[model samples]
Target: MKKKIYIYILVCTFVFRIISPAYISASTVYYDEYVTVSYVSDISGTSFPSTKTSYLWEGEHMVYKFQLSEPTIIKAYFSWSQSDEVPGGIAWFSKDMYGVDIIGNTAAISSKNKYNLILLEPGTYYINYSFGKRGSYKNAYNIGLSIAGQKVNTNTLVSASSWENPNVIRTDFYYEGFLSNLQPSAHYLFSVSSKSYVTIDYLFKQVDNLKADSAKCTLYYRNGRVIKSQKYDTRDTSKNKIAVLLEPGDYYINLSDATAPTSLYVIAEPRTNTLTQSIKRYTNKDVTVWLDSSYDHERALMVSSKVTDSNIRSNTVWKTSRNDTCLVIEEDFFTVSENGWYTVRTEDENENYVMTTINITNIDKVPPTTNIVNNKTYTSKSITIRFDDDVSGVKSAKLNGKVINYGKVVKAKGKYKLVITDQAGNAKTVVFTKK
Candidate 1:
């Protein structure tokens, strides 16, 4: 009785736990915000310390400091004149702890962009800006910043065309799970079972002028061998690129910029559906060619066939692009001076190739016929059969589940003797009674 009571208590605890809500820590709550910083140096003849909201060319670095009551997140935004090749800018953090540094060569940030900074336990941070060279024209911008569920400031920081932009700028706290930490120098393989082409969408940042001719693409196989190399040309202003016709296999994608070392990306899980020779046949006369195309995108259809012998007069018998499943080749008449092997291939929409073989033998193909006695009625327990042409092979007959035998060998029942031949042996069945 005591043991039963103890077991009952254990079951109650398990049930109670299953119905209970999970506990969450206070740190599980995420905080997010945005910060915008525009630099328009004193290029518009606008004087600072006057009606202008920002300084044009102070000739000194501008720093913004924030004191924190608790740890929070921050992001900075800015833009430089790309229209006239104005000096570039870079940004980084200058706090007591040297927490987070977000800096890249001077570039445009017209679109809403964000970069990550370190997670602060509790501290102050100063965002500083420096331009490479100031142009003669001051640019306009609206920098939006947010911190710990709050907006940092609404003011715009414009730089004069006379000051240089920093090498890097911007900082923010991102959701721990939201960003991908993949480096651009990694390669991976992708698998696509069907025998077809593959397309890859490549995303990259420009290292130097967009007109650089050294911007190229390099592909590497899993064995670390170079497979293909090609140059990229695009008129689209968008920053994404695409590559096509890559066989399925793990590969390394290298984006070579004229200005810097090549960046690499990984492509995992490669696959292929390639065509290979299936059979070899010898033919002096026209023969129908049949191929297997089961491993393609859809049904296999005849694409094209090439004639090797100039004297062979044969026309295309049948062809289709609507995925006929079976890859077949038909010829009106095959005429050849010499006997050799012929090749047939099937292709998918993506141009993946599948191949099959055919062998042409130098044998006579005389039509063989069957002669049935007592046309309508066959022997009660035996069937009378005769062949128009002499049958050289002896085979057994099977009906339903019973095997019938008579002598050392059996004659062909008729032209339609239901003959099935293989390398092992030959067999023919005679059906007299329906049952």
Candidate 2:
């Protein structure tokens, strides 16, 4: 019996050694990789209360970290497939280092899939998720993570900044913003080529009854002119939608709080129509395209800076039809390679081709190159910067990383370090001290 006990102990030790602390080394992925999500915490109580598979807590925030060796492009995006509740908040880096939120409520997986392809110098980066203004923190639903080493700009409606606060919004998708003590206002920008209806779902989740004027949201024009306003109260539990009928043009959304912070989600639903193809094209500085909508068997012609209107082949189609062909641009819409003169050709079932000329006027996507005209002529007050190429507009001009107001400094100055970012999102940082 003593001998048998010793043998049993030996067997137990062997089993423990084989199974103890298994470690999987990080693999070097050269190509793209759909990153599977593993739940770090089990959902219970308010820690995370939702039917969704993935989620994040408000204050602690869910940190999803991924690592890849060797320098490559990192394409990050999330999908809330078939879920009733989407993230009512923000999805950016763990800390706001990028100065831009990767995704937000109004700009999640709306009508199209959107991904931000950033080239990170090989290391581990955490993609953080959390709820923002509204009280929708405890639970978020249907979050998917996608990653790749190449550019994946396939989303149509990307989130943009609000006028009053930093809340991001997508004209085509939906977003939840807030008006609280710290941030008393929320803003969004939308445009329509023709008449369309707008909807704002204000979530009224309050403990006690409040006065009428305590909370309000107003729709306005791009230039800060009010179009209309609506009021809500704490007693209201239903998502009382404030709908507006407006003519074709540009507009903005402004949500404010009279007493306390309130949560509201913004969505723009274009009136549905049978696309029997006498195609009506619509666009603005920021445009939304429902190209992801099911339209197989039907064909669309694409005309841009490279292609002319005369170029039309029956086999031609919209780049958006293919998940990989679309390119994400200013308004988060899948459009041609560049913003310039372009045309789209749509065909009816009757084999008729209707074409629309679209002139995409916007800032230059190219980075500006700087050159000092004269080395002999220089002063502290003035420094002449001649760009290699004329840009649509200079977003910001700086000398030695200091704020140099345009027209304030002349063509005379000390050593020059000129850094400029044009309209197209490209940036150039040149450090040459007025040599």
Candidate 3:
């Protein structure tokens, strides 16, 4: 009975924990009567003056109090110019304490907005400011109060997105962001199953006035070494690739900035499910080339291929792009090189080269000629449909009119409709009825 009661109590406690509300403190107490003002050289504390109105979950705050001589209306603003911090807090230029009528609350004070507090009858007033929390840390902030209308609040008190933010991603996603004065680096945390190859790629939208490795990115394993940028004299800013094996765990990635206010793209996913590969067709778009923008290393054609010892063809080093920090790299396999894989490496030593796999797959719009190639002529156990040309790979095969869920392996014998798809996604169906 005692054991049963203990277990019952445990279950009840768990249930209570689940149902209980999170711990939240009450708002800051308001002054009913006018508060006295005392001048200090500076508000002394680790953080800016924060009250219940402050957004700081963990930090200190500064306080200031002064008298307006008589009743007066004033415009009070928080400026970060001298303080070097963006702050959010409550400030009052007028004291309307005890009056049933309500007053101002804490709000963000920045370059764009200022708080205008009307002192119906100013005897004594207190202007308090504190630091606001940004993300998961409580950092330092210097706040400057500017009283625009009737100059009341002062004394250098201190404190301190969404898709445009460092969004968390689970599966394959392609998101674009910028590195600017506001945000210099973009950070991300992602997950992957154990023993999976994570493929990450980032490219500069505009390759002007940046080095070859100027725009860099790093993928750090949850608690392991991932990858980072490399220093190279050449200016080749082809889309950099990071293909690495990762254990099942969360990982952190930081997109390092090349130049302030530069535009870039980030593509992340498993290696097998990698995206952003351009195709080479027989006509106009035969060769896709990336250019080098620096005049010193001007026009150096950058080329890489699947073959470890790659053979780079088109070798016409041209002039660099205007204000360019990029090198020209081309991926082209003309008629002679019908089928194969191509790739290009970034400057990073540990970085995996960006792969563009080209199977030169059957672009045959027409159905592939097929014949029944099976041992023992006819068999009920299994059947094989052989096409004239080797395909990109097997897609699916069916048995009888009913579909056979044969994976890559082909099996089962009956009226079969075998659909073979090539690299370009063109499908050819072959129907064979086996006894």
* Cα lDDT, all candidates: 0.32, 0.43, 0.38
Whole-model alpha-carbon lDDT for candidate 1: 0.32
Task: State residue 58's C-alpha deviation in candidate 3, in Å.
Answer: 49
lDDT of 2 at 409: 41
Sort order, lDDT high to low = 2, 3, 1
TM-scores of all predicted structures: 0.33, 0.25, 0.24
Per-residue lDDT tens digits of candidate 1, residues 1-435?
111110101124343233211111101111122123222321122211211122223112234445543322233444332332323333445452121232222223223342223222234555544333322224433222322212122111211111132111111211110001111122333343333344343433332122335455556665658766666444442333333445433444444443221222222222232232322332223444434344433333332333343312223422334434223444311232223355455445555444333444432233333333322434344444443322322333333444433321333342222232222242333333211
TM-score of 3: 0.24
Alpha-carbon RMSD to native, per candidate: 21.1, 31.9, 22.3
- Over 4 Å off, model 3: 1-166, 207-213, 224-226, 230-234, 260-435
TM-score leaderboard ranking: 1, 2, 3
Query: What is the C-alpha local distance difference test score of candidate 3?
Result: 0.38
- Scored by TM-score, the top model is 1
Show the lowest summed lDDT stretch of 10 residues, model 2: 1-10
The C-alpha stretches of model 2 lying farther than 4 A from their native spots are: 1-168, 207-213, 237-239, 258-261, 272-435
- Give the per-residue lDDT of model 3 (tens digit) for 1-435: 111110101124443233221101211223233223222223221122222121233222333344555323333455453344443444433232211112333344434344433322334555544344322235544445544222223111110022224446654655554443223455666777643556766554332222235556677755547555532223454536666655567777676644222222333333321213245443212333332221122112222234232422212212235413223443321222233343332222343223223343333333334455322335555554455434344344443344444332345544555665444345566555556
With candidate 1 superimposed using the best TM-score fit, by how many Å does residue 183's alpha carbon deviate from the native? 5.0
**Top lDDT: which candidate number?**
2
Model 1 residue 11 CA deviation in Å:
67
